[model samples]
Target: MDTENCTNLYLQVCQTFLTCKYDDPTTFDDLYKLLPWLRQSLTCCVCANVIVDPMSSTQSHCQHFVCGKCKGGKMILRPQCSWCKDAEVFETNQHLVVLVMCFKKICQLIASSPIYEHILNYDQQRKKELAAMKSDSPAKSDTPSKRKRPQRKFARTYVTSSLLNIPVQQVLQDAMNLKDVDINTQPPTVECKT
Candidate 1:
Protein backbone atom coordinates (compact mmCIF):
# COMPACT_ATOMS: atom_id res chain seq x y z
CA MET A 1 0.00 0.00 0.00
CA ASP A 2 2.58 2.59 1.19
CA THR A 3 6.17 3.02 -0.14
CA GLU A 4 7.69 0.70 2.52
CA ASN A 5 5.10 -1.99 1.99
CA CYS A 6 5.62 -1.57 -1.75
CA THR A 7 9.38 -2.21 -1.31
CA ASN A 8 8.98 -5.42 0.70
CA LEU A 9 6.33 -6.74 -1.67
CA TYR A 10 8.55 -5.66 -4.52
CA LEU A 11 11.40 -7.74 -3.07
CA GLN A 12 9.23 -10.88 -2.81
CA VAL A 13 7.69 -10.27 -6.22
CA CYS A 14 11.07 -9.67 -7.91
CA GLN A 15 12.52 -12.80 -6.30
CA THR A 16 9.59 -14.85 -7.56
CA PHE A 17 9.92 -13.44 -11.08
CA LEU A 18 13.69 -13.96 -11.34
CA THR A 19 13.40 -17.41 -9.74
CA CYS A 20 10.84 -18.38 -12.31
CA LYS A 21 13.07 -17.19 -15.15
CA TYR A 22 16.58 -18.16 -13.91
CA ASP A 23 17.13 -18.17 -10.17
CA ASP A 24 20.52 -19.80 -10.65
CA PRO A 25 21.90 -16.27 -11.21
CA THR A 26 24.64 -17.48 -13.60
CA THR A 27 24.98 -14.14 -15.43
CA PHE A 28 25.05 -10.42 -14.54
CA ASP A 29 21.77 -9.77 -16.42
CA ASP A 30 19.79 -11.91 -13.95
CA LEU A 31 21.30 -9.98 -11.03
CA TYR A 32 20.62 -6.68 -12.83
CA LYS A 33 16.98 -7.58 -13.41
CA LEU A 34 16.61 -8.75 -9.82
CA LEU A 35 18.31 -5.61 -8.44
CA PRO A 36 15.78 -3.22 -9.99
CA TRP A 37 12.95 -5.36 -8.65
CA LEU A 38 14.76 -5.60 -5.31
CA ARG A 39 15.01 -1.80 -5.05
CA GLN A 40 11.31 -1.48 -5.82
CA SER A 41 10.50 -4.08 -3.14
CA LEU A 42 12.60 -2.41 -0.42
CA THR A 43 10.06 -2.40 2.41
CA CYS A 44 10.42 -3.14 6.13
CA CYS A 45 8.98 -6.50 7.09
CA VAL A 46 8.11 -5.41 10.67
CA CYS A 47 6.04 -2.21 10.25
CA ALA A 48 5.33 -2.67 6.52
CA ASN A 49 7.37 0.51 6.09
CA VAL A 50 9.31 1.66 2.97
CA ILE A 51 13.07 2.05 3.26
CA VAL A 52 14.22 5.51 2.13
CA ASP A 53 17.85 4.62 2.88
CA PRO A 54 18.85 1.02 3.53
CA MET A 55 22.39 2.20 4.50
CA SER A 56 25.56 1.16 2.69
CA SER A 57 25.10 0.36 -1.12
CA THR A 58 21.33 1.25 -0.92
CA GLN A 59 18.22 -0.92 -0.33
CA SER A 60 18.72 -3.24 -3.30
CA HIS A 61 22.25 -4.32 -2.30
CA CYS A 62 21.98 -4.06 1.51
CA GLN A 63 19.62 -6.14 3.66
CA HIS A 64 19.40 -3.92 6.78
CA PHE A 65 15.82 -2.68 7.37
CA VAL A 66 14.17 -0.02 9.55
CA CYS A 67 10.73 0.00 11.22
CA GLY A 68 8.49 2.87 12.34
CA LYS A 69 8.41 1.73 16.01
CA CYS A 70 12.14 2.10 16.89
CA LYS A 71 12.05 5.65 15.38
CA GLY A 72 14.46 4.94 12.49
CA GLY A 73 16.68 2.64 14.58
CA LYS A 74 18.43 -0.38 13.03
CA MET A 75 17.61 -4.03 13.71
CA ILE A 76 19.15 -7.37 12.81
CA LEU A 77 18.05 -9.15 9.64
CA ARG A 78 14.57 -10.80 9.98
CA PRO A 79 13.86 -9.64 13.51
CA GLN A 80 10.60 -9.84 15.47
CA CYS A 81 7.67 -7.77 14.23
CA SER A 82 6.50 -6.16 17.51
CA TRP A 83 9.82 -5.32 19.22
CA CYS A 84 13.07 -4.38 17.39
CA LYS A 85 14.95 -6.82 19.62
CA ASP A 86 14.10 -10.54 19.40
CA ALA A 87 14.06 -11.09 23.20
CA GLU A 88 10.58 -12.61 23.45
CA VAL A 89 11.20 -15.05 20.55
CA PHE A 90 12.50 -18.51 21.41
CA GLU A 91 16.17 -19.30 20.59
CA THR A 92 15.24 -21.85 17.94
CA ASN A 93 12.75 -19.48 16.32
CA GLN A 94 15.07 -16.43 16.33
CA HIS A 95 18.61 -17.62 15.65
CA LEU A 96 20.08 -18.32 12.20
CA VAL A 97 23.65 -18.43 10.90
CA VAL A 98 24.86 -17.57 7.41
CA LEU A 99 28.09 -19.38 6.49
CA VAL A 100 30.39 -17.94 3.83
CA MET A 101 33.65 -19.71 2.98
CA CYS A 102 36.51 -18.24 0.91
CA PHE A 103 39.90 -19.56 -0.26
CA LYS A 104 41.71 -18.75 2.99
CA LYS A 105 38.93 -17.87 5.39
CA ILE A 106 36.49 -20.64 6.29
CA CYS A 107 33.43 -19.32 8.07
CA GLN A 108 31.03 -21.49 10.07
CA LEU A 109 28.16 -20.58 12.38
CA ILE A 110 25.74 -22.17 14.82
CA ALA A 111 22.03 -21.45 14.29
CA SER A 112 18.97 -21.99 16.45
CA SER A 113 15.94 -22.54 14.24
CA PRO A 114 12.69 -24.27 15.15
CA ILE A 115 11.90 -24.70 11.45
CA TYR A 116 15.16 -25.70 9.68
CA GLU A 117 18.43 -27.53 10.38
CA HIS A 118 21.90 -26.14 9.46
CA ILE A 119 24.32 -29.07 9.68
CA LEU A 120 26.93 -29.17 6.90
CA ASN A 121 25.56 -31.95 4.67
CA TYR A 122 28.21 -31.40 1.98
CA ASP A 123 31.11 -32.06 4.41
CA GLN A 124 29.54 -35.34 5.51
CA GLN A 125 29.11 -36.35 1.87
CA ARG A 126 32.76 -35.50 1.14
CA LYS A 127 33.97 -37.55 4.12
CA LYS A 128 31.94 -40.55 2.91
CA GLU A 129 33.51 -40.27 -0.55
CA LEU A 130 37.02 -40.14 0.97
CA ALA A 131 36.29 -43.17 3.14
CA ALA A 132 35.02 -45.10 0.10
CA MET A 133 38.18 -44.25 -1.79
CA LYS A 134 40.31 -45.46 1.12
CA SER A 135 38.37 -48.74 1.33
CA ASP A 136 38.71 -49.34 -2.46
CA SER A 137 42.50 -48.87 -2.43
CA PRO A 138 44.69 -51.43 -4.27
CA ALA A 139 46.72 -53.89 -2.18
CA LYS A 140 50.53 -53.69 -2.27
CA SER A 141 52.40 -56.17 -4.53
CA ASP A 142 55.46 -58.18 -3.31
CA THR A 143 56.61 -60.18 -6.38
CA PRO A 144 59.04 -58.48 -8.79
CA SER A 145 58.26 -58.46 -12.55
CA LYS A 146 60.49 -60.36 -15.08
CA ARG A 147 61.82 -57.24 -16.83
CA LYS A 148 65.58 -56.63 -17.25
CA ARG A 149 67.74 -54.48 -19.54
CA PRO A 150 71.48 -53.68 -20.05
CA GLN A 151 72.55 -51.36 -17.23
CA ARG A 152 74.74 -48.34 -18.00
CA LYS A 153 77.23 -47.08 -15.44
CA PHE A 154 76.43 -43.80 -13.74
CA ALA A 155 79.26 -41.20 -14.00
CA ARG A 156 79.62 -38.79 -11.08
CA THR A 157 80.84 -35.20 -11.72
CA TYR A 158 84.28 -34.37 -10.17
CA VAL A 159 85.31 -30.97 -8.76
CA THR A 160 88.69 -30.28 -10.50
CA SER A 161 89.50 -26.80 -9.17
CA SER A 162 87.63 -26.97 -5.86
CA LEU A 163 88.39 -25.03 -2.63
CA LEU A 164 90.04 -28.21 -1.25
CA ASN A 165 92.54 -28.47 -4.17
CA ILE A 166 93.19 -24.69 -4.49
CA PRO A 167 92.04 -22.24 -1.78
CA VAL A 168 89.77 -19.72 -3.57
CA GLN A 169 90.65 -16.91 -1.13
CA GLN A 170 94.46 -17.41 -1.84
CA VAL A 171 93.81 -17.39 -5.63
CA LEU A 172 91.86 -14.10 -5.30
CA GLN A 173 94.63 -12.60 -3.11
CA ASP A 174 97.27 -13.57 -5.76
CA ALA A 175 95.12 -11.89 -8.50
CA MET A 176 94.89 -8.71 -6.37
CA ASN A 177 98.72 -8.67 -5.85
CA LEU A 178 99.24 -9.11 -9.66
CA LYS A 179 96.99 -6.05 -10.32
CA ASP A 180 98.46 -3.85 -7.49
CA VAL A 181 102.26 -4.44 -7.49
CA ASP A 182 104.54 -2.41 -5.18
CA ILE A 183 106.64 0.62 -6.51
CA ASN A 184 109.76 -1.47 -5.75
CA THR A 185 108.58 -4.06 -8.35
CA GLN A 186 109.76 -1.45 -11.00
CA PRO A 187 106.81 0.25 -12.80
CA PRO A 188 107.47 3.62 -11.06
CA THR A 189 105.36 6.78 -11.71
CA VAL A 190 107.12 10.15 -12.46
CA GLU A 191 105.38 13.12 -10.65
CA CYS A 192 105.76 16.56 -12.37
CA LYS A 193 104.78 19.57 -10.14
CA THR A 194 105.34 23.33 -10.59
Candidate 2:
Protein backbone atom coordinates (compact mmCIF):
# COMPACT_ATOMS: atom_id res chain seq x y z
CA MET A 1 0.00 0.00 0.00
CA ASP A 2 1.08 3.58 -0.65
CA THR A 3 2.35 5.12 2.57
CA GLU A 4 -0.06 8.09 2.38
CA ASN A 5 -3.05 5.88 1.71
CA CYS A 6 -1.94 3.44 4.37
CA THR A 7 -1.72 6.24 6.94
CA ASN A 8 -5.25 7.44 6.15
CA LEU A 9 -6.63 3.89 6.26
CA TYR A 10 -4.82 3.30 9.55
CA LEU A 11 -6.53 6.33 11.07
CA GLN A 12 -9.93 5.09 9.91
CA VAL A 13 -9.27 1.65 11.35
CA CYS A 14 -8.26 3.17 14.67
CA GLN A 15 -11.36 5.41 14.74
CA THR A 16 -13.71 2.48 14.15
CA PHE A 17 -11.92 0.35 16.69
CA LEU A 18 -11.98 3.09 19.31
CA THR A 19 -15.65 3.91 18.68
CA CYS A 20 -16.80 0.34 19.10
CA LYS A 21 -18.26 -0.58 22.51
CA TYR A 22 -17.83 -4.34 22.70
CA ASP A 23 -20.10 -4.72 25.71
CA ASP A 24 -22.82 -2.42 24.38
CA PRO A 25 -25.60 -4.01 22.34
CA THR A 26 -26.28 -0.75 20.47
CA THR A 27 -22.71 -0.26 19.25
CA PHE A 28 -23.61 -1.37 15.72
CA ASP A 29 -26.29 1.28 15.26
CA ASP A 30 -24.14 3.84 17.04
CA LEU A 31 -21.31 3.29 14.57
CA TYR A 32 -23.80 3.25 11.68
CA LYS A 33 -25.14 6.63 12.77
CA LEU A 34 -21.61 7.93 13.33
CA LEU A 35 -20.40 7.10 9.82
CA PRO A 36 -23.39 8.01 7.63
CA TRP A 37 -21.42 7.89 4.37
CA LEU A 38 -20.32 4.27 4.82
CA ARG A 39 -23.67 2.75 3.79
CA GLN A 40 -24.07 4.80 0.60
CA SER A 41 -20.48 4.21 -0.48
CA LEU A 42 -20.61 0.42 -0.08
CA THR A 43 -24.17 -0.20 -1.30
CA CYS A 44 -24.70 -1.96 -4.62
CA CYS A 45 -26.75 0.07 -7.09
CA VAL A 46 -28.56 -2.99 -8.43
CA CYS A 47 -29.46 -5.09 -5.39
CA ALA A 48 -29.54 -2.24 -2.83
CA ASN A 49 -27.08 -4.22 -0.70
CA VAL A 50 -23.49 -3.70 0.46
CA ILE A 51 -21.10 -4.59 -2.35
CA VAL A 52 -18.65 -7.35 -1.60
CA ASP A 53 -16.93 -7.10 -4.98
CA PRO A 54 -17.50 -3.62 -6.38
CA MET A 55 -17.46 -3.23 -10.16
CA SER A 56 -18.21 0.04 -11.92
CA SER A 57 -19.72 0.46 -15.39
CA THR A 58 -17.59 1.64 -18.31
CA GLN A 59 -19.93 4.31 -19.65
CA SER A 60 -18.80 7.83 -18.78
CA HIS A 61 -22.38 8.70 -17.94
CA CYS A 62 -22.86 5.55 -15.86
CA GLN A 63 -20.34 5.27 -13.03
CA HIS A 64 -22.76 3.43 -10.77
CA PHE A 65 -21.66 0.12 -9.19
CA VAL A 66 -23.09 -3.37 -9.29
CA CYS A 67 -21.91 -6.01 -6.86
CA GLY A 68 -20.05 -9.08 -8.19
CA LYS A 69 -23.13 -11.28 -7.90
CA CYS A 70 -25.25 -8.85 -9.94
CA LYS A 71 -22.61 -8.49 -12.63
CA GLY A 72 -21.75 -12.19 -12.55
CA GLY A 73 -25.34 -13.15 -13.43
CA LYS A 74 -25.14 -11.03 -16.59
CA MET A 75 -21.59 -12.26 -17.33
CA ILE A 76 -23.01 -15.18 -19.39
CA LEU A 77 -24.06 -12.50 -21.80
CA ARG A 78 -22.47 -9.02 -21.48
CA PRO A 79 -22.60 -7.39 -18.07
CA GLN A 80 -25.16 -4.57 -18.14
CA CYS A 81 -25.07 -1.31 -16.25
CA SER A 82 -27.69 -1.41 -13.53
CA TRP A 83 -28.44 2.30 -13.50
CA CYS A 84 -28.12 3.22 -17.19
CA LYS A 85 -29.27 -0.19 -18.50
CA ASP A 86 -26.47 0.06 -21.05
CA ALA A 87 -24.63 -2.97 -22.38
CA GLU A 88 -21.43 -1.84 -20.71
CA VAL A 89 -18.05 -3.18 -19.75
CA PHE A 90 -17.03 -3.22 -16.10
CA GLU A 91 -13.81 -2.68 -14.15
CA THR A 92 -12.82 -2.73 -10.52
CA ASN A 93 -13.49 0.65 -8.90
CA GLN A 94 -10.21 1.19 -7.03
CA HIS A 95 -11.55 3.90 -4.72
CA LEU A 96 -14.39 1.71 -3.52
CA VAL A 97 -12.01 -1.23 -3.38
CA VAL A 98 -9.73 0.56 -0.92
CA LEU A 99 -12.65 1.75 1.21
CA VAL A 100 -14.07 -1.76 1.31
CA MET A 101 -10.73 -3.29 2.23
CA CYS A 102 -10.16 -0.79 5.03
CA PHE A 103 -13.61 -1.04 6.59
CA LYS A 104 -14.81 -4.53 5.69
CA LYS A 105 -13.67 -6.30 8.87
CA ILE A 106 -15.20 -3.75 11.25
CA CYS A 107 -18.40 -3.64 9.18
CA GLN A 108 -18.74 -7.42 9.04
CA LEU A 109 -18.34 -7.70 12.82
CA ILE A 110 -20.95 -5.02 13.53
CA ALA A 111 -23.48 -6.31 11.00
CA SER A 112 -23.18 -10.02 11.80
CA SER A 113 -22.39 -10.01 15.53
CA PRO A 114 -25.50 -8.18 16.73
CA ILE A 115 -28.82 -9.92 17.13
CA TYR A 116 -31.32 -8.50 14.61
CA GLU A 117 -34.28 -8.54 16.99
CA HIS A 118 -32.44 -6.41 19.56
CA ILE A 119 -31.68 -3.73 16.99
CA LEU A 120 -35.30 -3.63 15.84
CA ASN A 121 -36.61 -3.34 19.38
CA TYR A 122 -34.14 -0.57 20.23
CA ASP A 123 -35.12 1.44 17.15
CA GLN A 124 -38.83 1.05 17.88
CA GLN A 125 -38.38 2.15 21.49
CA ARG A 126 -36.19 5.11 20.45
CA LYS A 127 -38.89 6.30 18.04
CA LYS A 128 -41.56 6.08 20.72
CA GLU A 129 -39.41 8.06 23.17
CA LEU A 130 -38.79 10.79 20.60
CA ALA A 131 -42.50 10.99 19.81
CA ALA A 132 -43.38 11.30 23.47
CA MET A 133 -40.72 13.98 23.99
CA LYS A 134 -42.06 16.05 21.11
CA SER A 135 -45.70 15.77 22.17
CA ASP A 136 -45.08 16.42 25.87
CA SER A 137 -42.91 19.50 25.38
CA PRO A 138 -44.33 22.97 26.10
CA ALA A 139 -44.77 25.60 23.38
CA LYS A 140 -41.88 27.81 22.24
CA SER A 141 -43.60 30.73 24.01
CA ASP A 142 -42.35 29.25 27.28
CA THR A 143 -39.15 30.70 28.75
CA PRO A 144 -35.88 28.98 27.84
CA SER A 145 -35.22 28.35 31.52
CA LYS A 146 -38.57 26.54 31.87
CA ARG A 147 -37.84 24.24 28.91
CA LYS A 148 -35.94 21.05 29.65
CA ARG A 149 -33.03 19.94 27.46
CA PRO A 150 -32.44 16.35 26.60
CA GLN A 151 -29.28 14.83 28.05
CA ARG A 152 -26.67 13.42 25.72
CA LYS A 153 -25.81 9.79 26.32
CA PHE A 154 -22.47 8.11 25.69
CA ALA A 155 -21.74 4.42 25.31
CA ARG A 156 -20.01 2.41 28.01
CA THR A 157 -16.40 1.83 27.00
CA TYR A 158 -13.56 -0.46 28.07
CA VAL A 159 -9.80 -0.16 27.96
CA THR A 160 -7.91 -2.57 25.73
CA SER A 161 -4.54 -2.92 23.95
CA SER A 162 -5.71 -4.88 20.94
CA LEU A 163 -6.22 -3.44 17.45
CA LEU A 164 -8.84 -5.71 15.97
CA ASN A 165 -6.89 -9.01 15.75
CA ILE A 166 -3.39 -7.63 16.33
CA PRO A 167 -2.05 -6.58 19.69
CA VAL A 168 -0.85 -2.95 20.00
CA GLN A 169 2.49 -4.11 21.40
CA GLN A 170 2.94 -6.40 18.40
CA VAL A 171 2.13 -3.54 16.00
CA LEU A 172 4.73 -1.33 17.70
CA GLN A 173 7.33 -4.09 17.39
CA ASP A 174 6.45 -4.60 13.69
CA ALA A 175 6.69 -0.87 13.02
CA MET A 176 10.18 -0.77 14.46
CA ASN A 177 11.20 -3.72 12.24
CA LEU A 178 9.70 -2.12 9.06
CA LYS A 179 13.10 -0.72 7.94
CA ASP A 180 14.16 -4.31 7.04
CA VAL A 181 10.97 -4.99 5.02
CA ASP A 182 10.48 -4.50 1.28
CA ILE A 183 7.40 -2.38 0.39
CA ASN A 184 7.20 -3.25 -3.32
CA THR A 185 7.12 -7.03 -2.80
CA GLN A 186 3.82 -8.81 -2.38
CA PRO A 187 3.11 -11.04 0.60
CA PRO A 188 3.09 -14.81 0.07
CA THR A 189 -0.22 -16.36 -0.89
CA VAL A 190 -1.61 -19.82 -0.10
CA GLU A 191 -3.23 -21.97 -2.79
CA CYS A 192 -6.48 -23.84 -2.06
CA LYS A 193 -7.50 -27.16 -3.65
CA THR A 194 -11.00 -28.51 -4.12
Candidate 3:
Protein backbone atom coordinates (compact mmCIF):
# COMPACT_ATOMS: atom_id res chain seq x y z
CA MET A 1 0.00 0.00 0.00
CA ASP A 2 1.03 3.63 -0.58
CA THR A 3 2.39 5.81 2.23
CA GLU A 4 -0.68 8.09 2.30
CA ASN A 5 -3.05 5.11 2.69
CA CYS A 6 -0.82 3.64 5.37
CA THR A 7 -0.82 6.99 7.24
CA ASN A 8 -4.64 7.16 7.03
CA LEU A 9 -4.87 3.63 8.44
CA TYR A 10 -2.55 4.59 11.32
CA LEU A 11 -4.66 7.67 11.99
CA GLN A 12 -7.82 5.59 12.20
CA VAL A 13 -6.16 3.03 14.45
CA CYS A 14 -4.73 5.76 16.75
CA GLN A 15 -8.15 7.41 17.01
CA THR A 16 -9.72 4.09 17.98
CA PHE A 17 -6.98 3.39 20.52
CA LEU A 18 -7.38 6.85 22.06
CA THR A 19 -11.16 6.63 22.18
CA CYS A 20 -11.31 3.09 23.63
CA LYS A 21 -13.63 2.76 26.67
CA TYR A 22 -11.88 1.04 29.58
CA ASP A 23 -14.65 -0.76 31.52
CA ASP A 24 -12.62 -2.89 33.94
CA PRO A 25 -9.11 -1.75 34.93
CA THR A 26 -6.74 -3.36 32.43
CA THR A 27 -3.08 -3.04 31.40
CA PHE A 28 -1.38 -1.73 28.20
CA ASP A 29 -1.47 -5.30 26.80
CA ASP A 30 -5.01 -4.71 25.61
CA LEU A 31 -4.10 -1.38 24.01
CA TYR A 32 -1.08 -2.92 22.23
CA LYS A 33 -3.33 -5.59 20.77
CA LEU A 34 -5.82 -2.97 19.54
CA LEU A 35 -3.10 -0.86 17.84
CA PRO A 36 0.00 -2.98 17.17
CA TRP A 37 1.69 -0.47 14.83
CA LEU A 38 1.44 2.52 17.23
CA ARG A 39 4.96 2.24 18.66
CA GLN A 40 6.80 1.48 15.39
CA SER A 41 5.07 3.99 13.12
CA LEU A 42 5.18 7.03 15.43
CA THR A 43 8.94 7.71 15.17
CA CYS A 44 11.09 10.44 13.64
CA CYS A 45 13.42 9.68 10.70
CA VAL A 46 16.36 11.86 11.72
CA CYS A 47 16.35 11.69 15.54
CA ALA A 48 14.72 8.22 15.75
CA ASN A 49 12.70 9.57 18.72
CA VAL A 50 8.96 9.02 19.13
CA ILE A 51 7.12 11.67 17.11
CA VAL A 52 5.22 13.19 20.04
CA ASP A 53 4.87 16.61 18.32
CA PRO A 54 3.29 14.88 15.26
CA MET A 55 3.80 17.89 12.97
CA SER A 56 5.87 15.89 10.49
CA SER A 57 6.35 15.74 6.72
CA THR A 58 6.33 12.71 4.47
CA GLN A 59 8.62 13.01 1.48
CA SER A 60 6.96 12.07 -1.83
CA HIS A 61 9.31 9.40 -3.24
CA CYS A 62 11.31 8.49 -0.13
CA GLN A 63 8.23 8.01 2.14
CA HIS A 64 10.45 8.61 5.16
CA PHE A 65 9.09 10.04 8.43
CA VAL A 66 10.95 13.39 8.47
CA CYS A 67 10.45 15.43 11.64
CA GLY A 68 9.92 19.21 11.41
CA LYS A 69 13.50 20.04 12.48
CA CYS A 70 15.15 17.64 10.00
CA LYS A 71 12.83 18.70 7.19
CA GLY A 72 13.55 22.41 7.82
CA GLY A 73 17.36 21.96 7.82
CA LYS A 74 17.26 19.70 4.72
CA MET A 75 15.04 22.19 2.86
CA ILE A 76 17.65 24.92 3.27
CA LEU A 77 20.46 22.83 1.71
CA ARG A 78 18.41 21.09 -1.05
CA PRO A 79 14.71 21.37 -1.86
CA GLN A 80 14.29 17.62 -2.36
CA CYS A 81 13.42 14.51 -0.43
CA SER A 82 16.34 13.44 1.77
CA TRP A 83 15.99 9.74 0.86
CA CYS A 84 14.84 9.73 -2.78
CA LYS A 85 15.79 13.20 -4.11
CA ASP A 86 12.20 13.85 -5.25
CA ALA A 87 11.81 17.61 -5.96
CA GLU A 88 8.09 17.83 -5.23
CA VAL A 89 6.74 19.62 -2.16
CA PHE A 90 6.50 17.34 0.87
CA GLU A 91 2.97 16.39 1.97
CA THR A 92 1.95 17.36 5.55
CA ASN A 93 0.54 14.52 7.63
CA GLN A 94 -2.46 16.21 9.29
CA HIS A 95 -3.81 12.98 10.78
CA LEU A 96 -0.67 12.60 12.90
CA VAL A 97 -0.95 16.23 14.03
CA VAL A 98 -4.53 15.77 15.20
CA LEU A 99 -3.64 12.54 17.03
CA VAL A 100 -0.75 14.23 18.85
CA MET A 101 -2.96 17.18 19.83
CA CYS A 102 -5.57 14.78 21.25
CA PHE A 103 -2.85 12.95 23.18
CA LYS A 104 -1.53 16.24 24.63
CA LYS A 105 -5.00 17.28 25.79
CA ILE A 106 -5.48 13.92 27.49
CA CYS A 107 -2.12 14.33 29.28
CA GLN A 108 -3.05 17.87 30.37
CA LEU A 109 -6.38 16.70 31.77
CA ILE A 110 -4.66 13.97 33.75
CA ALA A 111 -1.99 16.33 35.10
CA SER A 112 -4.46 19.04 36.23
CA SER A 113 -6.62 16.70 38.37
CA PRO A 114 -6.70 16.98 42.20
CA ILE A 115 -4.56 13.85 42.57
CA TYR A 116 -1.54 15.64 41.01
CA GLU A 117 -2.10 18.98 42.82
CA HIS A 118 0.46 18.24 45.56
CA ILE A 119 3.16 17.33 43.02
CA LEU A 120 2.49 20.51 41.02
CA ASN A 121 2.59 22.70 44.13
CA TYR A 122 5.86 21.15 45.26
CA ASP A 123 7.46 21.79 41.85
CA GLN A 124 6.35 25.46 41.91
CA GLN A 125 7.72 25.95 45.45
CA ARG A 126 11.07 24.38 44.46
CA LYS A 127 11.34 26.77 41.49
CA LYS A 128 10.63 29.79 43.72
CA GLU A 129 13.30 28.70 46.24
CA LEU A 130 15.89 28.25 43.46
CA ALA A 131 15.11 31.72 42.09
CA ALA A 132 15.47 33.28 45.54
CA MET A 133 18.86 31.60 46.09
CA LYS A 134 20.13 32.84 42.70
CA SER A 135 19.04 36.43 43.47
CA ASP A 136 20.76 36.35 46.89
CA SER A 137 24.23 35.41 45.50
CA PRO A 138 26.82 38.18 45.87
CA ALA A 139 28.68 39.55 42.79
CA LYS A 140 32.21 38.12 42.49
CA SER A 141 33.67 41.03 40.48
CA ASP A 142 35.80 43.61 42.34
CA THR A 143 34.66 46.41 39.98
CA PRO A 144 31.82 48.66 41.14
CA SER A 145 28.41 47.13 40.43
CA LYS A 146 26.31 49.15 37.96
CA ARG A 147 22.77 50.11 38.97
CA LYS A 148 20.30 47.78 37.26
CA ARG A 149 17.58 49.47 35.24
CA PRO A 150 13.94 48.72 36.07
CA GLN A 151 12.10 46.70 33.46
CA ARG A 152 8.87 47.86 31.84
CA LYS A 153 6.03 45.37 31.51
CA PHE A 154 3.60 45.78 28.64
CA ALA A 155 0.12 44.29 29.09
CA ARG A 156 -2.69 43.76 26.60
CA THR A 157 -5.86 45.76 27.30
CA TYR A 158 -9.11 43.95 26.46
CA VAL A 159 -11.97 46.37 26.00
CA THR A 160 -15.70 45.57 26.03
CA SER A 161 -18.60 47.20 24.20
CA SER A 162 -19.83 48.82 27.43
CA LEU A 163 -16.44 50.42 28.08
CA LEU A 164 -15.94 51.64 24.45
CA ASN A 165 -19.59 52.67 23.96
CA ILE A 166 -19.74 50.57 20.74
CA PRO A 167 -20.52 47.02 19.65
CA VAL A 168 -17.74 44.61 20.65
CA GLN A 169 -17.66 42.89 17.28
CA GLN A 170 -17.49 46.24 15.46
CA VAL A 171 -14.65 47.40 17.72
CA LEU A 172 -12.74 44.14 17.08
CA GLN A 173 -13.18 44.52 13.30
CA ASP A 174 -11.95 48.09 13.44
CA ALA A 175 -8.97 47.06 15.58
CA MET A 176 -8.05 44.42 13.01
CA ASN A 177 -7.90 47.06 10.25
CA LEU A 178 -5.91 49.50 12.38
CA LYS A 179 -2.97 47.12 12.82
CA ASP A 180 -0.31 49.86 12.58
CA VAL A 181 -1.24 51.65 15.80
CA ASP A 182 1.61 53.98 16.87
CA ILE A 183 3.62 52.28 19.61
CA ASN A 184 5.04 55.63 20.82
CA THR A 185 1.57 56.74 21.97
CA GLN A 186 1.45 56.07 25.74
CA PRO A 187 -1.67 54.92 27.54
CA PRO A 188 -3.36 57.39 29.92
CA THR A 189 -1.86 57.17 33.43
CA VAL A 190 -3.64 57.51 36.76
CA GLU A 191 -1.77 58.69 39.89
CA CYS A 192 -2.37 56.97 43.27
CA LYS A 193 -0.65 57.17 46.70
CA THR A 194 0.38 53.94 48.36
- Ordered list by lDDT, greatest first: 2, 3, 1
Clash pairs detected, candidate 2: none
Best by TM-score: 2
Report the C-alpha lDDT of model 1 over 1-194, residue by residue, as the tens digit.
13344345444433543343222323223322332233323333333223321212122323334422333443423322343344222111100111001100110111121100212232354457878998999976778658857552321111111212222222222222322212223322467898
lDDT of 2 by residue, 139-183 (tens): 675446766787523211110111222322222233333223232
Among all candidates shown, the one with the greatest lDDT: 2
Ranking by TM-score: 2, 3, 1
Better by lDDT, candidate 3 or 2: 2
In model 1, state the lDDT of residue 75: 40
Better of 1 and 2 by TM-score: 2
Give residue 97's error in model 3 in angstroms. 1.8
Clashes of 3: 0
Question: In model 2, where do residues sit more than 4 Å from their true spots?
Answer: 1-32, 72-83, 108-124, 127-194
Q: What is the TM-score of each candidate against the true structure?
A: 0.17, 0.39, 0.33
Model 1 deviation from native, Cα RMSD in Å? 35.8
